[model samples]
Target chain A: MKTQHEVEQFLYRQAELLDSKQWQAWIDLFTDDGVYWMPPEPSHRTWEGMPAIFAEDKNLMRVRMGRVLHPDAWSQRPLWGTNHVVSNVVIVKSSTNEVQVRSRFHMMELRRDDVRHYAGAYTHRLKKTRGGYRIKLQRVDMTNAQAAYDYVLQVWV
Target chain B: MLQERIPDFSKFVEPDRVRKEVYTDAGVFEREMERIHETLWIYCGHESQVPKAGDYYAVQLGRQPMLMVRGPEGKVHVLYNRCPHRGNMMCGDRHGNTGEFFRCSYHAWTFHHDGRLRNIPMMESGYQGTRYGRDNPECSMKRAARVESYRGFVFASLAKDGPTLKEFLGASLVAFDDMCDRAPEGEVEIVPNCFRIIQHSNWKIFLENQLDALHPSVTHQSTGRAAHEVEKMIEKKTGKAPLSYHMLSAFATVTIDKWDNFQTINHPQGHCILTGYMGLRPKDPDTLKYEKTLIKAYGQKRMEEILGVNIHHVLIYPGLSVQSPLQQLRAVRPLGVDRTLTEIWHFRLKGAPEAIYRRSLAYYNLVNSPATVVNADDLENFWKCHQGLSSDGGDWVSFARHFGRDIEKDGVVESGPGMGTSEAPMRNQMKAWARYMGNGK
Candidate 1:
């Protein structure tokens, strides 16, 4: 029984958690079966066709988290700093236990001498938890679908 | 005076060995762009990318900017991306449809999809008898020296004469075969998108590392070991570690002995393939359903044969690597002597079960995707290798591990066995490098 404004607050809160690199806290926001997916095709639906990007469950997300913190994780040597700005929040559909939401985001990631802006649209299927809500799926559609880019850092949407 | 000692490129390399400078030299990179990237049958986007008339995708080969477009007459054409009028780029977008013809962005000059001039804006009035006109082919976008397609994959060569595209691909054409054969309908669908990573290192570093069996356990040791620990905990708690752990722990769990158990098959034309590293076949319902569907599409025997084929990685040297087991391909485009761009793309096995595709997608996300820890480990080393090579610590980065132990049978070099320490793959690639950089003796 969360209002639309409350849902928007939840979205922005997730962004803040990411921006602060609160890795484990971010992991706690997902339901057990939640999926983290980013389609290589920015405009494609993950349910309708193959997803170029997919993290099926929490264990995969944990593995990603482990790599981010692992000392041998060489790619993060000069650890990257990110600003996740999630906006355009809208509740697409809602039920007693689950709701679908859509939003747009612009993320600025600074690593070494390179600064990249990742702008995209996101679709989230969330389940209402006893405490609050848990994410079931989050899909990211990037604007630069076809351009050659730096290797992706950890997961995002 | 430094230009005077460009080091006799010929004497520095033999058929089996090459000087490290061939990999870390700026002068050599310039020569490769002209002699190899420009002369060889360089791959462009697939035909499916430009399915409709007037559709085009821009690609760069060496210093030449080119576009692969579908002409109005239903033919795929490869044209230099520059407009002949004022040398402006024809299509600024990576891909788009020009409706019927290309209109230059700088000037309003229009050309047919096949690089034939269609209009000059103010034609007869502006240039009554001038050298420029709509009928002049020179006034249009220039086509590449040669363009051809094989089973829908497009490739263009800047050189007028060399081997045909097929001849150039040689055993390397297995990149296409391994993929197309896996398709139930004899086709694969491009994901319509890609992960592009620009590594601050020489392109050779990435290519050399693709088939190198030695670095994974060391480079990804921490990720692998951490994943392994979590996997054991998960197994104790849940009776099984999710496949994601398998994706990471495989790096740590696949002992040096098991790595030696696998083998690399080196072929001519710089193409090579490593033995399969995964045991993907299982008797699960998802797999059973896929096998049944494949059996129905192909025959029972054909289905069994296709499903049971064991393969893990294929290194189509000089540029591309295909992990058919995972339905992924990484094309290496060298940006400079110390810079490289890797375009990673995943494919879906057309007509396969959605779950099967998901496994491929998971593998794609796990091992090859930029988000994956496996890729992060690999990229870090590419940079470190570049930095280390640039140092004055040593004049040569040795490819001498298990050097003489390689077995040569019918032109294929086979390395025996070792865990996380075989330099054989590097030697094989450098061997091929020597041949390509060497004059055709």
Candidate 2:
């Protein structure tokens, strides 16, 4: 049985990987068929009906990772330095091989001396793997999902 | 303030160059809001936005906060959002049903969807015959000088009299026609909400860049190259790359010199249209299925004619850019001299299959969304352009490329042979601006 402390540690490790821009390690945390979604609005319950900020499968995620890691990605010419603070972690559901965890996150991103704070709720569906845990589905709901933004939101929150 | 600081409008705008103050000076920006935006037929919202009788969408037309609502008889009305009493905004939220009447939260003053006063609390007891009557036009919300819709696309004019919306649109009316004609049902419906992005640049810079064919290779080369590599990899592994990749990789493959192959047609009203460069009609199963449906609905010959309309982007003067082929549009709202808000909205081709709608959605997310690298690159250049124009290092912004190589027939300007990369759109826009500002008229 995986304890709450184990789940918390797993989430913290994932945050560190993303914060450090460890692209390969971060992508590795997702299963072969994993999904990452960020709905465009708070009222969005499914990704099918309306457009989303991001509703990427493994292939699209790989493309996004490639763009961010590429030296020529001008938007990320100097990569955004981010610190993700994950809290209020709760295991919403659990089984022998899979778990659904919900948590709140506050991400502080800095690039070109400009800082932006993004707060949101994250719901992650994870599965136990031989090496560790792989993300089955990761859904992020940004607090300012509906607000007009000054620039492109290039990072995952 | 700008009347004294800036030179004559004739000196500021020429056929091939424009003074930097036109894009950088705050005073000039305000004047533009008064002379251009306020005097033009600015796009408000789609008719589908307010489908129901009480539904409304709050929008900004130049400096005025306005609401586009549907009345009891299913007629659309555009009115200033200010309440008659105390001048508070009536609709606070971005959009919602006003429940048959709009009631101001501050004082409970009510008005019908058509902006006629419905009731004021205790009107008979509190006050009477003191210029607060229900019949007084001043006591109700002020309507726009004129409101009209062309093919479900709504536009409002603040000027009391001018050319009708049709006259203003002129040849540019094809933007809506081409979009609606694509749908098998011969109409379109909005896909609910849109992506509102605030760009830190002069609004003109955004409009000019919409038809500028010279920068795609330099600005989006990296993203395009990356997507190209992945697309090739996918083709090797799966025998085909998705259509979404072409949407990005085209930025690289369509080199600067090749951009000349696609011509831009300049219109009298400052509107411009760019001929399509990308081959959107892929022969995949999804596309084939969609084509078959179109053939059945529109017939083989009519379907070919509908799909054969080749256009990339159409600029509707100073305020809107429509990508009819992709079923997307962007409405430009100038908030300040250096801050512009763009509302990016996509449409669903009614009666088309789910796969066709998905294609539009993919284009929306990959090319137009604020989260995409393609749009990010454009945003960066917009900011940089504004920053450079603000500095004294440059005095004149050049539109000199292929300036003398444009042919005028009737009232429309077409690029000369092999001069498709010309800055005719920018020149044409300034010409119209000069006229509107009372310099060339």
| Highest lDDT model number | 2
Share of real interface contacts recovered by each model?
A: 0.58, 0.52
Model 1 docking category: acceptable
DockQ of each: 0.46, 0.62
Candidate 1 C-alpha lDDT tens digits along B283-354: 778888888888888989988777666677788767878787677888777888988888777877888888
- The top-ranked prediction according to DockQ is 2
Residue pairs in steric clash, candidate 2? none
Q: Model 2 segments beyond 4 Å from truth? A: B1-7, B439-441
Give residue B362's lDDT in candidate 2 (0 to 100): 89
Model 1 lDDT on a 0 to 1 scale: 0.76
Clashes per candidate (backbone, < 3 Å): 4, 0
Candidate 1 wrong stretches, greater than 4 Å: A1-13, A39-42, A47-49, A52-56, A77-80, A83-147, A155-157, B1-6, B11-20, B122-129, B133-136, B225-245, B417-421, B438-441
lDDT of 2 by residue, B1-441 (tens): 644564477778988999999888887787788888988999999999999999999999888999999998999999999998999999898999999798999999999888999898999887675877787788898999999999999999999989999999998999999999989999999999689999889999999999898888887887777788888888999999878888877887888888888889999899999986458788788878888889989899999998889898899999899999889999999999999999999999999889889888988887776577678878878988998998989799999999888999987998877778899999999998888877325
Worst 10 residues of 2 chain B by lDDT: B1-10
